[model samples]
Target: MARIGVLLMAYGTPRSLEDVEAYYTHIRGGRPPSPERVAELQERYRRIGGRSPLFEITLRQAQALEARLARLALGHSFRIRVGMKHSPPFIDEAVAGLLEEGIERLVAIALAPHYSRMSVGAYHAAVREALARRSAALPVAEIRGWGSHPLFVIAVAERLKEALEDLPRQETMVIFTAHSLPARLREEGDPYETELLDSARRVARVLGLDHWRFAYQSASATGEPWLGPDLLEVLEAIARQGEARHVVVCPIGFLADHLEILYDLDVEAREAAEGWGLSFRRTRSLNDDPLLIETLMALVSEALAD
Candidate 1:
């Protein structure tokens, strides 16, 4: 009998303000942050209720996915777990737990819809390291990118439609956004940007949207050039044009509400939009959206079939 393990992975968040430094260190790849830098990071978490619900939301996702799978009655033993990249229940820990559950096969996917070497690639590396450290050579598979999954596009389009219902469609410009990555990925020929654009385009087509554009958001302060024109930059430009009365930002890259959605989009970006005298509203995050769960289940089934 073959038991399967389905692991859901996310970027992770600190449990509380006090854990921000440790989380920051993990994100920096173990480079300890300066005191000032730590304070700045801590403040961001503080603004978002002094904590992030990323892990909790991901746990709910895992639980929901498990129940859905059980309903399918696949007649195979299966278990689901949530893992984080920069917090407790790290990827290695999740993998170890799956092994302990006697799962002979693994199916994994990141909460991120798109892929970047800096993102999904890092996740793959973490899984490999975890497996190697445990001396476990198990069959594992993953869906590196599901940005163009039909259900995913439909889910996004539905959300966009719901957000635009009260606004004059022609007077609004839909801005599809995703977390920014380093500009170097372009020179390195990473497929991340292209995939992101593809997802945005598909969702727009589904909605039959005419006035829409894609922009990057939440760039890191890594002292390197990042993908842009940023959401704020785009909003400022749109305000200058005086064409659209409202700007709706749909974060196609993120699937859940976290610091990025709460602070980056709602707080920071909203402030920028206000400065430009432009109306700003972000689409509700796809946290536990039934369609999103179905999308994940499809990915798991695809991995298991292979």
Candidate 2:
């Protein structure tokens, strides 16, 4: 088989105090972030473990893809490797290795399902930049957004089903939450918010669930209107109504468990839910789910087909 490469990119995480400044600086475009800010961010990572499991999780993902490829006779003709936008294993390195491998074609996928200029577009930028520096032109294809992929829908819906099973059975609302983008991105005609809503509707349909609505999380209110009603506001609205029994949150944006899933949903949102006199619960992250691994392999297969 002719040589090929598969690149997977994600919004990387910091594993330690050793990495915190550099990671944040990369996210901030090399601007110096305050020491206080760095410390706080490190604390967030520390809450989950002494380090971020992103690299480890990503390696596991790569290994799983390799095994699946081998079993299906795909092999490493399409070598799968990971790159992080703001970490040690940067996209440029991943691309350079692929180029060095004498691979003639490439396929790229972002860990995030929904699209946004700020997130997925960043990965696209990495590829474009890498190709520019290379001596050869490579045929590359990227999966735009799998918000509506059949297996993708099934995976998220099943998680929602599990959440529904634990609810109190009457007037429970499934609050669909995803990371927020700046309103400017929306004004620029970025379809992130719209696509997120579309994913939420599809998942709700699959689970036969109604009374569900999308909310934004991980928002920065620094003098800009972010997408809303934010999760807290949604909880406030439910509190005012005083009728709902539970607010089950399902994070459709993130495929793996991370600080946002742990702190935002489990801690911040949970606090709001409890204080507002409503039950709070969030569906588990896909986090290396075997079915999700299959879906990812299918995505790789589709990209290669293209």
Candidate 3:
């Protein structure tokens, strides 16, 4: 019997400081990064323990998801593989491999919770390109968005509660942040920002968080403006208000503890908060959490049933 392939995709990270240049170039659409930009990225990676564990974490997620699928599906055969957008085991490669394995049916799910044409759509395009190149006619089902999945919302809200366990909830302002995209996408009516905010709202509603809000983070340095109010600006504004001294940043958009979380939030954001005399803490990333695994399984089951 032919097996079903579940391709788990994520925004790839550099394996080590040495891969920084290549990773940066890949993100820039093959335009190599300047030496200064390369050095800056290398320093960020160095600060976060000299490398990102994203690939390994994603692999673990795939293994766990495969096991769960096995138990859930019984005699059904399901094989899971990890795909990266900008690193090794690229989406196109993963698609090709699944086709080679005789997987007639595939479910391609982006690790990202929200959908954006620029992000999740790109992964689908990669799969299509690979199939076109191989002259294969495999049927692929894609999970476009699960931002408001109940289990996912609950899991993130639980993490937020854990982060606020000791901090005074009344005094703490909860900021839910997602990676920023080019502002032009807004004009294009990309539903990413809307979907992202909807997810955050669901989690906040679950936790009964009245002081919760949303912001954008990790905007690119492309001169053209990205989404806002940026996370750092939100922190500074809270300081100015002298209304809340404790702030909990929930990275609603990211599923793992990659550079954006490790360096951007832990290091840069922390410093900014300290400078503003505010206590800063970020909710733990849901990396390989059982809840996350369950969420993926739910999505797969739903896709297969449909």
Give all TM-scores, in the order shown.
0.98, 0.95, 0.98
Candidate 2 lDDT over residue span 193-233, tens digit each: 88888889898888777688788899864688888778899
**Full candidate order by lDDT, most accurate first:** 3, 1, 2
Top model by lDDT, which number? 3
Q: What is the C-alpha lDDT profile of model 1 across 159-252, one tens digit per residue?
A: 9999999999989999999999999999999999999999999998898899998899989888999999898889988999886989999999
Residue 249, model 3: lDDT of 95
What's the true lDDT of residue 180 in model 3? Answer: 95
List clash counts for every candidate, in order: 0, 0, 0
Model 3 residue 299 lDDT score? 94
Worst 10 residues of 2 by lDDT: 69-78
Alpha carbon lDDT at 3, candidate 1: 94
**Candidate achieving higher TM-score, 1 or 2:** 1
Candidate 2 regions exceeding 4 Å error are 74-76
lDDT of 3 by residue, 1-306 (tens): 558999999989888889999999999999998999999899998898999889999999999999999889545698788889999989888988888788878999999999999898998788778789998887789899789999999989999999988988789999999999998989999999999989998998888889977999999888898989899999999999986989999999999999999999999999999999999999999999999999999999888878
Residue-level lDDT for 50 in candidate 2: 60
Q: By the TM-score metric, which is better: model 2 or model 3?
A: 3
